[model samples]
Target: MKGCAFNVIIQLRELFNVEGQTVKIDDTVSAEELSALGGYEQYASDMRLLGKIANRAGVVTLSYAVSVTLRHLCDRCSEEFEREYGYELTHTLVTSLEDDGGEYEEDYILCPENALDLTELALSDLRLSLPTKILCREDCKGLCPECGKNLNEGGCDCGK
Candidate 1:
């Protein structure tokens, strides 16, 4: 899809009277647009659109639960690592954050005042699900501290 460099940002509030029996949002959220976000990395080949837009209750809540296959570089081994990120993402449409926050600790939701940029929403939800530290494995020996060679494959002789 052609992503407009000017209005790559979207406002969800623009979605009004948007009720569908089953609406797939992947079309709405473009991949090229997501790549533009700073430090944005998306691995999932597809986005699973599983949620509802309840314009009836004067609010729209979206639920996300999709598994993504991402190719990551191991911090230690410097090898390509394939990982899957799967989880449920939820958001509620309200007028302001003050309405939700100040009350209780809610997970993550969106406000109605702004247009619900599906692209931003997806990027944010995916970003939060990412791990702080990436490792090839739990017992990974990692690269040699001195020679900087991958120790998992036993191809380096750093101590010699």
Candidate 2:
């Protein structure tokens, strides 16, 4: 893969060499380029991935936690706010998949040529974990439909 701030390639050859071995990973993924993803204009900080890859009883697995602070506009009130999000992700690792016609494809992560781009995997997982509708708080009152006033602040003169 082309070298970049978020590209974290892990060599699986060494990990597979010894059974019951674990590899720790702690890295940051740059968020500047992710602004084009839509919804949010920027991130408060880079995404952090902390976890380990282990070969347990011949089954290789990757487990990690990703955390990041995002700057977003609350969908309800249209107020700008910063929120921290955390996601715990786990996946089974495999060097190759049996030809089952892609039946169980999504069950495992394929590390082609014994190389896995962890940052890419983590980013994908993070995106999937995000909420479809983002709100500053759980019980956001939202804005007044008639007056275009933020209800979270106070009620507007426009009744109903």
Q: Judged by lDDT against the true structure, how good is candidate 1? A: 0.58
Q: In candidate 1, residue 90 scores what lDDT?
A: 67
Off-target runs (Cα >4 Å) in candidate 1 are 1-33, 40-48, 55-59, 98-105, 112-114, 155-160
How far out, in Å, is residue 128 in model 2? 1.0
Separate clash counts for every candidate: 6, 0
Q: Assess every candidate by TM-score.
A: 0.67, 0.83
TM-score of 1: 0.67
Clashing pairs in 1: 11-115, 11-116, 12-115, 12-116, 13-115, 13-116
Which tens-of-lDDT digit does each residue in 8-36 have in candidate 1? 24345544445432233433333344454
Candidate 2 residue spans exceeding 4 A from truth: 1-5, 33-41, 99-107
List CA RMSD, all candidates. 4.5, 2.9
Q: What does the lDDT read for residue 52 in candidate 2? A: 95
How many residue pairs of model 1 clash at the backbone? 6
TM-score of 2: 0.83
lDDT of 2: 0.80
